[model samples]
Target: MVDTMALLLPFGRASRTTSPSAQHPAAGLPADDEVLLDAPDDRLGPALVAAGQGSHRAAADLLAATRALGRWDHRDRYVLRLAAFARSRPEWVQTWYAAAPDDPDVLLLRAQLAVDHAWGSPARAELLRGVSPLITAAARADDRDPVPWRLALDHARGSRAGHTYFGELWEAAVRRAPLHYGCHVAALRYLASSWHGSHRECLDFADRAAQDAPADSLVQALPARAALAYLNDGCGPGVPPERLHAA
Candidate 1:
């Protein structure tokens, strides 16, 4: 078997509980409004600005365009930014969700938001447990999209799920996008966590994934991420100098 477990990788809604500023809650957002997973695309910048101003149209349109174009990688990054925007400015997203309850973009954003919210809570595993259905619904919304499966892997890791379950998620992720960097990174984190201090196993998984993935694929840098992780934690044997050079 190809060790289906070798690959895997890994947002929330806005709420009205508190506002940084009643007039412009998102004022604290970056001056340039740079989003997480910053891609070079110019399209998303306008969408984020519009969302901050309480209009979901640009955000919705951008996500819709990404989905229509089958730009899964861009779609994934867009979802994270949109979800983060919602966290600070929930009203627009709530409106969007209410208007298009079943739109794949809407569903995916909602799932991302839920997971993001849950992950930050004091009760992480418990909060993540409740977000399971959202992730499932998002995954089912577009079976060909691996983004939801990526979220599922993150959820599984947050919930500290068993290997068998994560393996199933890993299979689903790679089946859709065999070398998705997000999923591969999630799997690496899981290995790092579950086998805590087992830097060799984590490096092994990362090296194999990086080797199998295309040169242009972000997955190719996964081994470097693993090396950095080991270096950061200063755990176990040092990553072989050869491996660092190869990465």
Candidate 2:
């Protein structure tokens, strides 16, 4: 886990001695013109454009490369962006699936799209349950990939599965990639939702996870997330300022 205090000590000391504008320019707020919302990276830009033109080859190739290299974080992000694109213009995804129905990348994207679609419906639990097979197939498609397991964790949560079932999914997720941020987040959300009003339990789980993860792992951010959730919940006991700062 990251030493949060160690990481923040320098900044904490600096805050007392320096003004905000005196900090490095790179650390300062960017100009309004500099901000670009939902901008795709260079590689993703081309794929998104091609998809807009009703082509899925570039997107497929991009996801395949990410998966082949075991870049799970990039794969997760790409799958989400691609799935969002499919929601608006689905022909490309359909064409890709028809061309290669067994492609793991497409399978994952399809599962994500299905879940996203189900989330907005009134019968979310029923719809989510119906999408279980898609998530299962995606998980089965790649034993070493943790993204599908993340989706499974989310599916289990939306479907209101029991603690034992959620735990089984959580185990499968961490077994694939213990430090994967998305899987950890999915687990955290499940804990927060399934065990409503159990703020202490959620914080403890987040703290333990952060302690076990590497300093540079995104899991290091879990405690801060837990703190945010607790604060937003309004039903929990008050968290001390020091503990919140440490998080």
In lDDT terms, which candidate is top? 1
What do the candidate models score in CA lDDT, each in turn?
0.76, 0.75
Worst 10 residues of 1 by lDDT: 8-17
Writing each residue's lDDT as its tens digit, candidate 2 over 119-227 gives 8899998899889899989988988999998898778778877776777777777778877888777777766733432656667778888888889887788888888
Per-residue C-alpha lDDT of model 1 across residues 102-217, encoded as one tens digit per residue: 88888999999999999899999888989999999998988888899889988988888888888999988888988776777778888884343266778888878777777798
Location of the lowest summed lDDT over 10 successive residues in candidate 2: 8-17
Error of 2 at 176 (Å): 0.8
Where is model 2 more than 4 Å wrong at Cα? 1-37, 193-197
Instruction: Compute the lDDT of residue 186 as modeled in candidate 2.
Output: 74
Best by TM-score: 1
